[model samples]
Target: MRLLVTGGSGYLGAAILKRAPATCELAATYLAHSIAQGNAAAFRVDVRDADAVNHLFDEFRPAVVMHAAAQMTGDQMLAVNGDGSRNIARAATRVGARLIHLSSDVIFDGEHAPYDESAPPNPISPYGESKARAERVVLDELPRAVIVRTSLIYGFDPLDPRTRQTLNGEMPRLFTDEYRCPIFVDDLADALLELAQHEFVGVLNLAGAQRLSRYEFGIKMANAFHAAPRFTGALSASYPGRRPRDCTLDISLAQKTLRTRLRGVDEVLQDLPGF
Candidate 1:
Protein backbone atom coordinates (compact mmCIF):
# COMPACT_ATOMS: atom_id res chain seq x y z
CA MET A 1 0.00 0.00 0.00
CA ARG A 2 1.17 3.50 -0.89
CA LEU A 3 0.45 6.21 1.72
CA LEU A 4 0.91 9.99 1.75
CA VAL A 5 1.35 11.70 5.11
CA THR A 6 1.13 15.45 5.51
CA GLY A 7 3.16 17.24 8.21
CA GLY A 8 5.72 14.49 7.88
CA SER A 9 8.15 16.48 10.04
CA GLY A 10 5.69 17.07 12.90
CA TYR A 11 5.80 15.21 16.21
CA LEU A 12 2.81 12.94 15.61
CA GLY A 13 3.24 12.73 11.86
CA ALA A 14 6.92 11.87 12.16
CA ALA A 15 6.10 9.22 14.76
CA ILE A 16 3.49 7.73 12.44
CA LEU A 17 6.01 7.63 9.61
CA LYS A 18 8.56 5.95 11.84
CA ARG A 19 6.09 3.30 13.09
CA ALA A 20 4.42 2.54 9.75
CA PRO A 21 4.94 -0.99 8.37
CA ALA A 22 7.90 -1.46 6.03
CA THR A 23 5.70 -3.24 3.52
CA CYS A 24 3.86 -0.01 2.79
CA GLU A 25 5.39 2.70 0.60
CA LEU A 26 5.36 6.12 2.29
CA ALA A 27 5.57 9.70 1.00
CA ALA A 28 5.14 12.81 3.07
CA THR A 29 5.23 16.64 3.07
CA TYR A 30 7.18 18.82 5.44
CA LEU A 31 6.64 22.47 6.30
CA ALA A 32 8.80 24.83 8.41
CA HIS A 33 11.37 22.04 8.87
CA SER A 34 13.23 19.81 6.47
CA ILE A 35 12.21 16.18 6.20
CA ALA A 36 14.05 13.69 8.43
CA GLN A 37 16.31 11.15 6.73
CA GLY A 38 14.48 7.86 6.31
CA ASN A 39 13.32 5.22 3.82
CA ALA A 40 10.21 7.26 2.95
CA ALA A 41 10.31 9.98 0.31
CA ALA A 42 9.65 13.45 1.76
CA PHE A 43 8.48 16.53 -0.16
CA ARG A 44 8.11 20.13 0.91
CA VAL A 45 4.43 20.98 0.48
CA ASP A 46 2.26 23.36 2.48
CA VAL A 47 -1.26 22.12 3.15
CA ARG A 48 -2.52 25.70 3.00
CA ASP A 49 -1.38 25.98 -0.61
CA ALA A 50 -3.91 24.19 -2.81
CA ASP A 51 -1.56 24.18 -5.79
CA ALA A 52 1.24 22.60 -3.79
CA VAL A 53 -1.12 20.01 -2.30
CA ASN A 54 -2.43 19.12 -5.77
CA HIS A 55 1.07 18.89 -7.19
CA LEU A 56 2.20 16.49 -4.48
CA PHE A 57 -0.90 14.34 -4.84
CA ASP A 58 -0.44 14.20 -8.60
CA GLU A 59 3.20 13.28 -8.25
CA PHE A 60 2.75 10.68 -5.49
CA ARG A 61 -0.64 9.23 -6.53
CA PRO A 62 -1.01 7.62 -3.14
CA ALA A 63 -3.77 5.15 -2.45
CA VAL A 64 -4.22 6.52 1.06
CA VAL A 65 -3.62 10.12 2.18
CA MET A 66 -3.23 10.68 5.91
CA HIS A 67 -3.97 14.37 6.59
CA ALA A 68 -1.98 14.88 9.78
CA ALA A 69 -0.62 18.31 8.85
CA ALA A 70 -2.29 21.38 10.39
CA GLN A 71 -1.54 24.80 11.83
CA MET A 72 -1.65 23.47 15.38
CA THR A 73 -1.20 26.16 18.03
CA GLY A 74 -3.28 28.13 20.50
CA ASP A 75 -2.49 31.38 18.64
CA GLN A 76 -2.84 30.41 14.94
CA MET A 77 -5.04 27.34 15.34
CA LEU A 78 -8.00 28.87 13.54
CA ALA A 79 -6.28 29.83 10.32
CA VAL A 80 -4.07 26.77 10.10
CA ASN A 81 -6.53 24.26 11.51
CA GLY A 82 -9.68 25.32 9.70
CA ASP A 83 -8.52 26.77 6.38
CA GLY A 84 -5.58 24.45 5.91
CA SER A 85 -7.84 21.41 6.42
CA ARG A 86 -10.31 22.57 3.80
CA ASN A 87 -7.55 22.85 1.21
CA ILE A 88 -6.25 19.36 2.02
CA ALA A 89 -9.68 17.73 1.87
CA ARG A 90 -10.42 19.35 -1.48
CA ALA A 91 -7.10 18.27 -2.94
CA ALA A 92 -7.49 14.72 -1.68
CA THR A 93 -10.97 14.47 -3.16
CA ARG A 94 -9.71 15.65 -6.52
CA VAL A 95 -6.96 13.06 -6.54
CA GLY A 96 -9.33 10.16 -5.84
CA ALA A 97 -7.34 9.16 -2.73
CA ARG A 98 -8.94 7.98 0.49
CA LEU A 99 -8.29 10.41 3.37
CA ILE A 100 -7.72 9.80 7.07
CA HIS A 101 -8.10 13.18 8.75
CA LEU A 102 -6.67 13.55 12.24
CA SER A 103 -9.00 15.46 14.50
CA SER A 104 -9.10 16.33 18.23
CA ASP A 105 -11.26 15.65 21.31
CA VAL A 106 -11.44 19.41 21.93
CA ILE A 107 -14.25 19.47 19.38
CA PHE A 108 -16.64 18.58 22.22
CA ASP A 109 -16.96 20.64 25.39
CA GLY A 110 -15.77 18.59 28.37
CA GLU A 111 -19.10 18.83 30.13
CA HIS A 112 -20.00 15.25 29.18
CA ALA A 113 -18.05 12.15 30.05
CA PRO A 114 -16.91 9.42 27.63
CA TYR A 115 -17.87 11.21 24.45
CA ASP A 116 -18.72 9.07 21.45
CA GLU A 117 -18.70 9.71 17.70
CA SER A 118 -22.31 10.88 17.77
CA ALA A 119 -21.76 13.60 20.38
CA PRO A 120 -22.43 17.03 18.96
CA PRO A 121 -19.41 19.31 18.71
CA ASN A 122 -19.26 22.05 21.27
CA PRO A 123 -15.83 23.52 20.68
CA ILE A 124 -14.63 25.95 23.36
CA SER A 125 -11.35 27.01 21.74
CA PRO A 126 -10.08 28.19 18.38
CA TYR A 127 -8.11 24.95 18.03
CA GLY A 128 -11.22 22.89 18.64
CA GLU A 129 -13.29 24.96 16.21
CA SER A 130 -10.76 24.47 13.47
CA LYS A 131 -10.65 20.71 13.94
CA ALA A 132 -14.43 20.52 14.06
CA ARG A 133 -14.66 22.44 10.82
CA ALA A 134 -12.08 20.22 9.22
CA GLU A 135 -14.07 17.15 10.22
CA ARG A 136 -17.19 18.53 8.59
CA VAL A 137 -15.47 19.45 5.34
CA VAL A 138 -13.62 16.17 4.96
CA LEU A 139 -16.68 14.04 5.65
CA ASP A 140 -18.97 16.15 3.49
CA GLU A 141 -16.56 16.07 0.58
CA LEU A 142 -15.77 12.40 0.86
CA PRO A 143 -18.17 10.17 2.70
CA ARG A 144 -15.62 7.39 2.80
CA ALA A 145 -13.06 9.47 4.69
CA VAL A 146 -11.93 8.40 8.18
CA ILE A 147 -11.98 11.13 10.83
CA VAL A 148 -9.92 10.04 13.85
CA ARG A 149 -10.35 12.32 16.87
CA THR A 150 -7.59 11.75 19.40
CA SER A 151 -6.40 13.60 22.52
CA LEU A 152 -3.28 14.71 24.50
CA ILE A 153 -0.84 12.63 22.39
CA TYR A 154 2.46 11.70 24.06
CA GLY A 155 5.45 9.60 23.04
CA PHE A 156 9.22 9.71 22.57
CA ASP A 157 10.60 12.09 19.98
CA PRO A 158 14.13 13.50 20.22
CA LEU A 159 13.30 16.38 17.89
CA ASP A 160 10.28 17.60 19.92
CA PRO A 161 11.13 20.35 22.42
CA ARG A 162 8.15 19.54 24.68
CA THR A 163 9.33 15.98 25.10
CA ARG A 164 12.89 17.24 25.61
CA GLN A 165 11.78 19.57 28.39
CA THR A 166 9.83 16.82 30.13
CA LEU A 167 12.86 14.52 29.92
CA ASN A 168 15.24 17.26 31.10
CA GLY A 169 13.07 18.37 34.08
CA GLU A 170 12.71 21.85 32.62
CA MET A 171 8.90 21.76 32.45
CA PRO A 172 7.17 19.02 34.40
CA ARG A 173 4.15 20.94 35.66
CA LEU A 174 0.71 19.78 34.48
CA PHE A 175 -2.86 20.94 34.98
CA THR A 176 -4.65 18.97 37.66
CA ASP A 177 -8.17 19.54 36.37
CA GLU A 178 -7.50 19.42 32.65
CA TYR A 179 -8.55 15.82 32.12
CA ARG A 180 -8.03 14.07 28.78
CA CYS A 181 -7.46 10.65 27.27
CA PRO A 182 -3.85 10.84 26.15
CA ILE A 183 -2.99 8.39 23.37
CA PHE A 184 0.49 7.10 22.70
CA VAL A 185 1.60 8.40 19.29
CA ASP A 186 2.75 4.99 18.08
CA ASP A 187 -0.54 3.34 19.02
CA LEU A 188 -2.53 6.09 17.35
CA ALA A 189 -0.51 5.69 14.18
CA ASP A 190 -1.13 1.96 14.16
CA ALA A 191 -4.85 2.52 14.63
CA LEU A 192 -4.95 5.10 11.86
CA LEU A 193 -3.28 2.72 9.44
CA GLU A 194 -5.83 0.05 10.32
CA LEU A 195 -8.69 2.51 9.94
CA ALA A 196 -7.40 3.39 6.49
CA GLN A 197 -8.08 -0.19 5.39
CA HIS A 198 -11.57 -0.47 6.90
CA GLU A 199 -14.89 0.57 5.40
CA PHE A 200 -15.73 2.70 8.45
CA VAL A 201 -16.39 6.36 7.75
CA GLY A 202 -17.28 9.48 9.76
CA VAL A 203 -15.89 10.55 13.14
CA LEU A 204 -14.29 8.05 15.55
CA ASN A 205 -12.80 8.89 18.93
CA LEU A 206 -9.33 7.31 19.10
CA ALA A 207 -7.93 7.99 22.55
CA GLY A 208 -6.49 6.18 25.55
CA ALA A 209 -8.82 4.13 27.68
CA GLN A 210 -8.24 6.01 30.91
CA ARG A 211 -9.43 9.53 31.72
CA LEU A 212 -6.56 11.31 33.42
CA SER A 213 -5.85 14.85 34.46
CA ARG A 214 -2.72 16.43 33.09
CA TYR A 215 -1.15 16.18 36.53
CA GLU A 216 -1.80 12.44 36.76
CA PHE A 217 -0.41 11.89 33.27
CA GLY A 218 2.75 13.72 34.29
CA ILE A 219 3.14 11.51 37.34
CA LYS A 220 2.73 8.42 35.17
CA MET A 221 5.30 9.73 32.70
CA ALA A 222 7.76 10.50 35.46
CA ASN A 223 7.26 7.10 37.03
CA ALA A 224 7.57 5.31 33.70
CA PHE A 225 10.75 7.10 32.71
CA HIS A 226 12.20 7.00 36.24
CA ALA A 227 12.43 10.77 36.12
CA ALA A 228 10.16 12.01 38.85
CA PRO A 229 9.57 15.74 38.63
CA ARG A 230 7.42 18.20 40.57
CA PHE A 231 3.92 18.73 39.18
CA THR A 232 1.48 21.61 39.61
CA GLY A 233 -2.28 21.39 39.32
CA ALA A 234 -4.42 24.30 38.13
CA LEU A 235 -8.05 24.86 37.23
CA SER A 236 -8.97 25.12 33.57
CA ALA A 237 -10.94 28.30 34.26
CA SER A 238 -7.73 30.10 35.21
CA TYR A 239 -6.53 29.81 31.62
CA PRO A 240 -7.11 32.43 28.92
CA GLY A 241 -9.42 30.61 26.50
CA ARG A 242 -12.51 28.56 27.33
CA ARG A 243 -11.84 24.87 27.94
CA PRO A 244 -13.82 21.81 29.00
CA ARG A 245 -13.06 20.28 32.37
CA ASP A 246 -13.12 16.60 31.25
CA CYS A 247 -13.16 15.33 27.67
CA THR A 248 -12.26 11.65 27.77
CA LEU A 249 -13.47 9.62 24.80
CA ASP A 250 -15.13 6.18 24.60
CA ILE A 251 -13.18 4.04 22.12
CA SER A 252 -15.49 1.00 22.21
CA LEU A 253 -16.17 1.28 18.49
CA ALA A 254 -12.50 1.49 17.70
CA GLN A 255 -11.76 -1.48 19.95
CA LYS A 256 -14.38 -3.55 18.18
CA THR A 257 -13.26 -2.60 14.69
CA LEU A 258 -9.51 -2.01 14.67
CA ARG A 259 -6.73 -4.57 14.99
CA THR A 260 -4.86 -2.53 17.61
CA ARG A 261 -6.36 -2.02 21.07
CA LEU A 262 -6.58 1.35 22.80
CA ARG A 263 -4.33 1.09 25.81
CA GLY A 264 -4.85 2.53 29.27
CA VAL A 265 -2.37 4.70 31.20
CA ASP A 266 -1.19 1.72 33.21
CA GLU A 267 -0.61 -0.28 30.04
CA VAL A 268 1.31 2.61 28.53
CA LEU A 269 3.34 3.21 31.66
CA GLN A 270 4.17 -0.48 32.08
CA ASP A 271 5.39 -0.58 28.50
CA LEU A 272 8.09 1.95 29.46
CA PRO A 273 11.51 0.31 29.61
CA GLY A 274 12.53 1.31 33.13
CA PHE A 275 9.18 1.43 34.78
Candidate 2:
Protein backbone atom coordinates (compact mmCIF):
# COMPACT_ATOMS: atom_id res chain seq x y z
CA MET A 1 0.00 0.00 0.00
CA ARG A 2 1.23 3.49 -0.92
CA LEU A 3 0.35 6.18 1.65
CA LEU A 4 0.87 9.94 1.61
CA VAL A 5 0.48 11.94 4.84
CA THR A 6 0.07 15.69 4.71
CA GLY A 7 1.32 17.81 7.70
CA GLY A 8 3.90 15.08 8.30
CA SER A 9 5.93 17.32 10.64
CA GLY A 10 2.89 18.16 12.76
CA TYR A 11 2.38 16.58 16.20
CA LEU A 12 -0.21 14.00 15.14
CA GLY A 13 1.26 13.51 11.67
CA ALA A 14 4.74 12.85 13.05
CA ALA A 15 3.31 10.33 15.50
CA ILE A 16 1.52 8.56 12.64
CA LEU A 17 4.73 8.34 10.61
CA LYS A 18 6.60 6.77 13.54
CA ARG A 19 3.99 4.02 13.92
CA ALA A 20 3.06 3.53 10.25
CA PRO A 21 3.16 0.08 8.66
CA ALA A 22 6.60 -0.93 7.33
CA THR A 23 5.16 -2.82 4.37
CA CYS A 24 3.45 0.30 3.05
CA GLU A 25 5.36 2.83 0.90
CA LEU A 26 5.24 6.07 2.91
CA ALA A 27 5.60 9.72 1.92
CA ALA A 28 5.09 12.89 4.00
CA THR A 29 4.35 16.59 3.32
CA TYR A 30 5.24 19.69 5.29
CA LEU A 31 4.73 23.43 5.06
CA ALA A 32 7.09 24.98 7.65
CA HIS A 33 8.51 21.99 9.58
CA SER A 34 11.11 19.46 8.46
CA ILE A 35 10.69 15.69 8.13
CA ALA A 36 13.41 14.88 10.65
CA GLN A 37 12.52 11.51 12.10
CA GLY A 38 10.45 9.44 9.65
CA ASN A 39 11.75 7.18 6.86
CA ALA A 40 9.12 8.71 4.52
CA ALA A 41 10.34 10.97 1.70
CA ALA A 42 9.50 14.63 2.28
CA PHE A 43 7.44 16.82 -0.06
CA ARG A 44 6.69 20.51 0.52
CA VAL A 45 3.02 21.00 -0.33
CA ASP A 46 0.52 23.84 -0.11
CA VAL A 47 -2.83 22.06 -0.26
CA ARG A 48 -4.47 25.28 -1.50
CA ASP A 49 -2.71 24.89 -4.84
CA ALA A 50 -4.78 22.43 -6.88
CA ASP A 51 -2.07 21.99 -9.48
CA ALA A 52 0.58 21.34 -6.84
CA VAL A 53 -1.66 18.78 -5.16
CA ASN A 54 -2.56 17.14 -8.47
CA HIS A 55 1.11 17.06 -9.50
CA LEU A 56 2.06 15.34 -6.22
CA PHE A 57 -0.74 12.81 -6.70
CA ASP A 58 0.33 12.08 -10.29
CA GLU A 59 3.93 11.57 -9.27
CA PHE A 60 3.34 9.59 -6.06
CA ARG A 61 0.21 7.69 -7.15
CA PRO A 62 -0.63 7.22 -3.48
CA ALA A 63 -3.20 4.53 -2.71
CA VAL A 64 -4.15 6.40 0.48
CA VAL A 65 -4.09 10.17 1.12
CA MET A 66 -4.23 11.23 4.77
CA HIS A 67 -5.20 14.94 4.65
CA ALA A 68 -3.98 16.16 8.07
CA ALA A 69 -2.73 19.60 7.01
CA ALA A 70 -4.69 22.69 8.16
CA GLN A 71 -4.16 26.24 9.38
CA MET A 72 -4.90 26.88 13.05
CA THR A 73 -6.13 30.48 12.81
CA GLY A 74 -6.39 33.73 10.79
CA ASP A 75 -7.66 34.03 7.17
CA GLN A 76 -5.30 31.19 6.31
CA MET A 77 -7.80 28.92 8.03
CA LEU A 78 -10.28 29.55 5.22
CA ALA A 79 -7.66 29.41 2.46
CA VAL A 80 -5.72 26.37 3.73
CA ASN A 81 -8.10 24.45 5.94
CA GLY A 82 -11.33 25.07 4.02
CA ASP A 83 -10.30 25.35 0.36
CA GLY A 84 -7.06 23.38 0.64
CA SER A 85 -9.05 20.35 1.76
CA ARG A 86 -11.21 20.68 -1.33
CA ASN A 87 -8.11 20.75 -3.51
CA ILE A 88 -6.81 17.57 -1.87
CA ALA A 89 -10.19 15.86 -2.13
CA ARG A 90 -10.37 16.70 -5.85
CA ALA A 91 -6.85 15.48 -6.43
CA ALA A 92 -7.52 12.27 -4.49
CA THR A 93 -10.67 11.60 -6.54
CA ARG A 94 -8.73 12.19 -9.75
CA VAL A 95 -6.04 9.72 -8.65
CA GLY A 96 -8.59 7.17 -7.25
CA ALA A 97 -6.88 7.29 -3.85
CA ARG A 98 -8.88 6.76 -0.66
CA LEU A 99 -8.95 10.05 1.25
CA ILE A 100 -8.95 10.28 5.04
CA HIS A 101 -9.52 13.88 6.16
CA LEU A 102 -8.89 14.96 9.77
CA SER A 103 -11.74 16.92 11.32
CA SER A 104 -12.47 18.37 14.82
CA ASP A 105 -15.26 18.28 17.40
CA VAL A 106 -15.38 22.10 17.40
CA ILE A 107 -17.30 21.81 14.11
CA PHE A 108 -20.38 21.45 16.29
CA ASP A 109 -21.68 24.05 18.73
CA GLY A 110 -21.01 23.36 22.43
CA GLU A 111 -24.75 23.36 23.06
CA HIS A 112 -24.88 19.72 22.00
CA ALA A 113 -23.50 16.93 24.14
CA PRO A 114 -21.57 13.92 22.85
CA TYR A 115 -22.07 14.68 19.16
CA ASP A 116 -22.43 11.82 16.67
CA GLU A 117 -21.53 11.44 12.98
CA SER A 118 -25.02 12.58 11.99
CA ALA A 119 -24.94 15.81 14.05
CA PRO A 120 -25.03 19.02 12.02
CA PRO A 121 -22.07 21.38 12.23
CA ASN A 122 -22.65 24.71 13.98
CA PRO A 123 -19.18 26.10 14.42
CA ILE A 124 -18.57 29.07 16.73
CA SER A 125 -14.95 30.01 15.96
CA PRO A 126 -13.09 30.77 12.73
CA TYR A 127 -11.01 27.60 13.04
CA GLY A 128 -14.13 25.56 13.68
CA GLU A 129 -15.87 27.12 10.67
CA SER A 130 -12.94 26.23 8.45
CA LYS A 131 -13.06 22.59 9.56
CA ALA A 132 -16.80 22.48 8.95
CA ARG A 133 -16.26 23.83 5.45
CA ALA A 134 -13.42 21.37 4.89
CA GLU A 135 -15.62 18.46 5.87
CA ARG A 136 -18.37 19.52 3.48
CA VAL A 137 -15.92 20.11 0.64
CA VAL A 138 -14.15 16.78 1.13
CA LEU A 139 -17.39 14.82 1.24
CA ASP A 140 -18.78 16.70 -1.75
CA GLU A 141 -15.64 16.19 -3.80
CA LEU A 142 -15.16 12.58 -2.69
CA PRO A 143 -18.25 10.89 -1.29
CA ARG A 144 -16.18 7.92 -0.18
CA ALA A 145 -13.85 10.02 1.96
CA VAL A 146 -13.36 9.13 5.61
CA ILE A 147 -13.68 12.24 7.80
CA VAL A 148 -12.31 11.43 11.27
CA ARG A 149 -13.60 14.05 13.71
CA THR A 150 -11.32 14.03 16.74
CA SER A 151 -10.71 16.07 19.89
CA LEU A 152 -7.59 17.60 21.51
CA ILE A 153 -4.55 15.33 20.90
CA TYR A 154 -2.06 14.83 23.77
CA GLY A 155 1.13 12.83 24.34
CA PHE A 156 4.52 12.90 26.14
CA ASP A 157 8.01 11.64 25.15
CA PRO A 158 8.76 14.11 22.36
CA LEU A 159 5.75 15.89 23.81
CA ASP A 160 2.90 17.61 21.89
CA PRO A 161 3.15 21.31 21.03
CA ARG A 162 0.36 22.42 23.37
CA THR A 163 1.46 20.07 26.14
CA ARG A 164 5.10 21.18 25.83
CA GLN A 165 4.04 24.81 26.03
CA THR A 166 1.90 24.16 29.09
CA LEU A 167 4.88 22.39 30.67
CA ASN A 168 7.13 25.37 29.94
CA GLY A 169 4.43 27.73 31.27
CA GLU A 170 3.73 29.04 27.77
CA MET A 171 0.05 28.06 27.91
CA PRO A 172 -0.60 29.14 31.48
CA ARG A 173 -4.36 29.25 31.31
CA LEU A 174 -6.46 26.16 30.49
CA PHE A 175 -10.25 26.55 30.54
CA THR A 176 -12.25 24.69 33.12
CA ASP A 177 -15.48 24.59 31.08
CA GLU A 178 -14.13 23.48 27.71
CA TYR A 179 -14.64 19.75 27.67
CA ARG A 180 -13.10 17.18 25.28
CA CYS A 181 -12.18 13.52 24.95
CA PRO A 182 -8.40 13.94 24.89
CA ILE A 183 -6.94 11.05 22.85
CA PHE A 184 -3.38 9.81 22.94
CA VAL A 185 -1.63 10.90 19.75
CA ASP A 186 -0.51 7.31 19.09
CA ASP A 187 -4.04 5.98 19.47
CA LEU A 188 -5.38 8.52 16.98
CA ALA A 189 -2.54 7.78 14.54
CA ASP A 190 -3.23 4.06 14.86
CA ALA A 191 -6.94 4.61 14.24
CA LEU A 192 -6.21 6.71 11.16
CA LEU A 193 -3.82 4.08 9.76
CA GLU A 194 -6.34 1.32 10.51
CA LEU A 195 -9.05 3.31 8.71
CA ALA A 196 -6.69 3.85 5.77
CA GLN A 197 -6.67 0.07 5.15
CA HIS A 198 -10.43 -0.29 5.52
CA GLU A 199 -13.40 0.37 3.22
CA PHE A 200 -15.07 2.64 5.81
CA VAL A 201 -16.22 6.03 4.56
CA GLY A 202 -18.06 9.12 5.88
CA VAL A 203 -17.68 10.67 9.36
CA LEU A 204 -16.42 8.78 12.42
CA ASN A 205 -15.82 10.09 15.99
CA LEU A 206 -12.27 8.97 16.83
CA ALA A 207 -11.41 10.26 20.33
CA GLY A 208 -10.49 9.09 23.84
CA ALA A 209 -12.86 6.96 25.90
CA GLN A 210 -13.24 9.42 28.78
CA ARG A 211 -14.61 12.99 28.53
CA LEU A 212 -13.06 15.72 30.70
CA SER A 213 -12.56 19.46 30.86
CA ARG A 214 -9.40 21.20 29.61
CA TYR A 215 -8.61 22.08 33.24
CA GLU A 216 -8.86 18.41 34.10
CA PHE A 217 -6.50 17.52 31.26
CA GLY A 218 -4.16 20.34 32.27
CA ILE A 219 -4.02 19.03 35.82
CA LYS A 220 -2.97 15.63 34.47
CA MET A 221 -0.23 17.25 32.37
CA ALA A 222 0.95 19.24 35.36
CA ASN A 223 1.14 16.12 37.48
CA ALA A 224 3.04 14.29 34.74
CA PHE A 225 5.53 17.12 34.14
CA HIS A 226 5.60 18.26 37.78
CA ALA A 227 4.80 21.79 36.65
CA ALA A 228 2.11 23.09 39.01
CA PRO A 229 3.19 26.74 38.87
CA ARG A 230 1.78 27.16 35.35
CA PHE A 231 -1.73 26.31 36.43
CA THR A 232 -4.04 29.37 36.25
CA GLY A 233 -7.53 28.66 37.49
CA ALA A 234 -9.51 29.93 34.51
CA LEU A 235 -12.77 29.08 32.77
CA SER A 236 -13.75 29.19 29.08
CA ALA A 237 -15.63 32.46 29.74
CA SER A 238 -12.32 34.04 30.74
CA TYR A 239 -11.06 33.79 27.16
CA PRO A 240 -11.77 36.42 24.54
CA GLY A 241 -14.45 35.75 21.89
CA ARG A 242 -16.24 32.39 21.53
CA ARG A 243 -14.90 29.00 22.65
CA PRO A 244 -16.61 25.64 22.25
CA ARG A 245 -17.79 23.98 25.48
CA ASP A 246 -18.65 20.31 25.94
CA CYS A 247 -17.65 19.21 22.44
CA THR A 248 -17.04 15.67 23.60
CA LEU A 249 -17.68 13.17 20.79
CA ASP A 250 -19.80 10.05 21.09
CA ILE A 251 -17.43 7.23 20.05
CA SER A 252 -19.76 4.21 20.25
CA LEU A 253 -19.52 3.65 16.51
CA ALA A 254 -15.74 4.00 16.56
CA GLN A 255 -15.40 1.65 19.54
CA LYS A 256 -17.46 -0.98 17.69
CA THR A 257 -15.82 -0.30 14.33
CA LEU A 258 -12.11 0.02 15.08
CA ARG A 259 -9.74 -2.70 16.33
CA THR A 260 -7.42 -0.17 18.02
CA ARG A 261 -8.30 0.53 21.63
CA LEU A 262 -9.08 4.24 22.05
CA ARG A 263 -7.59 4.59 25.53
CA GLY A 264 -8.74 7.38 27.83
CA VAL A 265 -6.57 10.16 29.35
CA ASP A 266 -6.03 8.46 32.74
CA GLU A 267 -5.10 5.13 31.15
CA VAL A 268 -2.75 6.74 28.60
CA LEU A 269 -0.95 9.08 31.04
CA GLN A 270 -0.63 6.52 33.85
CA ASP A 271 1.65 4.25 31.82
CA LEU A 272 3.41 7.09 29.97
CA PRO A 273 7.10 6.33 29.36
CA GLY A 274 10.10 8.60 29.93
CA PHE A 275 7.99 11.01 32.03
Q: Whose TM-score is greatest here?
A: 2
Q: Model 2, range 99-139, lDDT digits (tens) per residue?
A: 99999999988998879989999999999999999999999
Cα lDDT, all candidates: 0.81, 0.90
RMSD of 2: 1.1
Task: Name model 2 segments beyond 4 Å from true.
Answer: none
Q: Alpha-carbon error at 113 in model 2, in Å?
A: 0.9
lDDT by residue (tens digit), candidate 1, 111-179: 987799899989887778888888887777787788898988887654245545665767646678888
Which residue window of length 10 is worst by lDDT in model 1?
Answer: 156-165
Clashing residue pairs, candidate 2?
none
lDDT of 2 at 275: 58
lDDT of the structure predicted as candidate 1:
0.81
